[model samples]
Target chain A: MTVQATLKAPGEKLIRIRLELEAHEVREAAISGDFFIHPEESVSILEEALLGRPGTQEKLLKRLQDTVELGGLELVGISAESIASCALKAYENRKGPGKA
Target chain B: MEEWRLIIDRPGRGTYNMAVDLSILNSLARQACPPTLRLYSWYPPAITIGYFQRLEEEVRINKCRAAGVDVIRRVTGGGAVFHDRELTYSVFIPLSHSLALPSIRESYGLLCSPIVECLKSYGLNAHFSPVNDVLTGGAKLSGSAQTRRNGVLLQHGTLLVGADTELMFSLLNVSKEKSVAAAEGSPEGRVTSLSALLGELVLDGEFQTDLSMRLANAFAEGLGCVFVQAELSEAERREALEIEEGLFKREEWNRDRSIRPAFGAAGD
Candidate 1:
């Protein structure tokens, strides 16, 4: 797996993880930040959904946003646009289709 | 009046079982129905790890592949558990339900009290250990995990009516030094069985039935609500199938994405 991160602001970052997966499952994941989300238990929910998943850039970003949103994470400085852009770049880098 | 629902589902594969559990949880999140208790089993024994555990660390993929055991990760958190010949139970309760206990520890205690009581009835001293485990003389006979979201709480556990501990140790990659060190760090105790404890006090089938009854009564008393026997709603079944097809049964979701150790052999 290859991962990339683009920081949008303090307390917010967009991470794009390119997984070498043949199917649509999330096998593993890791999230680190300095913030608190309500109910503390929501982290477990996010972990369950993201781990062991196979997804394209758009789908993974959407799922991650949905998961965090469902768990009531406020999308402060990190916007969906940033996440998508970061994911697309990461995917391109992983593919190495452009720059030699 | 307390109504108890009994469901004895046909043995299904492990992924299917997990799909059903997730479906039930999703429905509960949607406020679809009353809290439910389900009793089920697996066809071929499988190994399920926690949601957060590293797949490489917790499972021996080559061993599992060679031995024909299915490996999957669960939606709940805890250590890895081997599901074989064991009675698995799950409970999904809406968070607002009066019966829905507050806090993880309280809920685990409430859900597992009956099992402990049933064990005592059979002359074994079983108690709920902290952080969600049932122990008898420090040996874990049952282990459970829980996940709460969208006003629904799903808790599931395995009762070791019987198991192959040696095979469990081997197939779970417990041979590695890190695994051994982790095991050593854990509270040391051997696994125990109901048959071993009963000493002929109860027949196998009767033991299962009696335990179920005790758990039902405990839930009724704990939550002050009735449990109606129910089957999977068509919507739930549909959701489960979709999730299974899209996630559980997929290879990328089941493997890969592991941050393999920087040192050691390539495969390790």
Candidate 2:
């Protein structure tokens, strides 16, 4: 399962990212951002949260929200709506029509 | 009294060394081996990344590959470290042991006291830095990391006897040129060598041997035990091979440097 999003600022290029999940833990994640914000620490925190746990859309969103809030990171130009929508799409894709 | 097993292994590759350490930790967890102390070295200097460090940002992969340096990821967490011209030590303690120190900091302090004493015996003022580093004159000469699982703790570190600082800088991502300029401009502290500490005592291999013995003895005495020289059991060797095959060799564990891209990229 995977979730992806692109965040862009006015007059700036878009930054794309994809989060792939496996067995409830984050298997691999890739990010290409127009602005550098030290993505490694954030990604690690996400990985730690996903490890050996059940990966659900709500759980994943909560993990990211909690980490960003606690760390006091600036989401800046990132679209929160896009993130939630992408996560839901990925979750739905993984669960299929009957399951969702 | 509890018996401490000592293993002095010949020079091996980095993967083998990590395998042995993990194997020892596993064996201790299973109560198949007594608390053990291992002294070993790497044949080709290796760059080991901490469990959490981004491989790309932490190591210069091309430089290491060109120099025939093996890169491995450790089960412990810390910054990346280059292992060359240094003695590596791993100590495993089971939770059931009466003398087992609680918490990472306490265990580091307890185990490193002997190293401090040994360095002092050689006329070098070495001190243990909080959170696991040994420094001389406020510059790190050794750094350690620990991992606890299944009631067993594995603490390991490098003792820099002699190192190629130029090569180290080339292999690591350290901004040495900038740091040196910064230091010259402001006199900031930097890494120091064991030879610098030994000064006139350079030619004395006997002193090094004595220091090693003293550290082993201190650990044994501190824990109310006798040191027993031993080799790896068949089970340990088997388990080590299995772990190496499974976790250590996996790209997901070692090369998946993407866990934190915000920090840096993956090492090639």
Of the candidates shown, which would achieve the greatest DockQ relative to the real structure? 2
Model 1, position B225: C-alpha lDDT score: 62
Provide the RMSD of all predictions against the true structure, rounded to 1 decimal. Answer: 12.0, 11.4
User: Would candidate 2 be rated incorrect, acceptable, medium or high by CAPRI criteria?
Assistant: incorrect
Number of backbone collisions per candidate, in order?
Answer: 13, 8
Candidate 1 error regions (>4 Å): A1-100, B1-6, B175-189, B199-207, B256-268
lDDT of 1 at A14: 24
The C-alpha stretches of model 2 lying farther than 4 A from their native spots are A1-100, B175-189, B205-208, B257-268
Candidate 2 pairs with clashing backbones: A38-B262, A39-B262, A40-B260, A40-B261, A40-B262, A40-B263, B56-B266, B56-B267
lDDT of 2 by residue, A4-83 (tens): 44343332223444557676454665543322122224534543443343356677677667766776543322333334
User: Candidate 2 chain B: worst 10 consecutive residues by lDDT?
Assistant: B259-268
Question: Taking the tens digit of each residue's C-alpha lDDT, what string does model 1 give over A1-100?
Answer: 4443332332332232333322434354343222223343454465455555325667766776788776764332244445445444543544464321
DockQ of each: 0.04, 0.04
Worst 10 residues of 1 chain A by lDDT: A29-38
Task: Identify the candidate with maximal lDDT.
Answer: 2
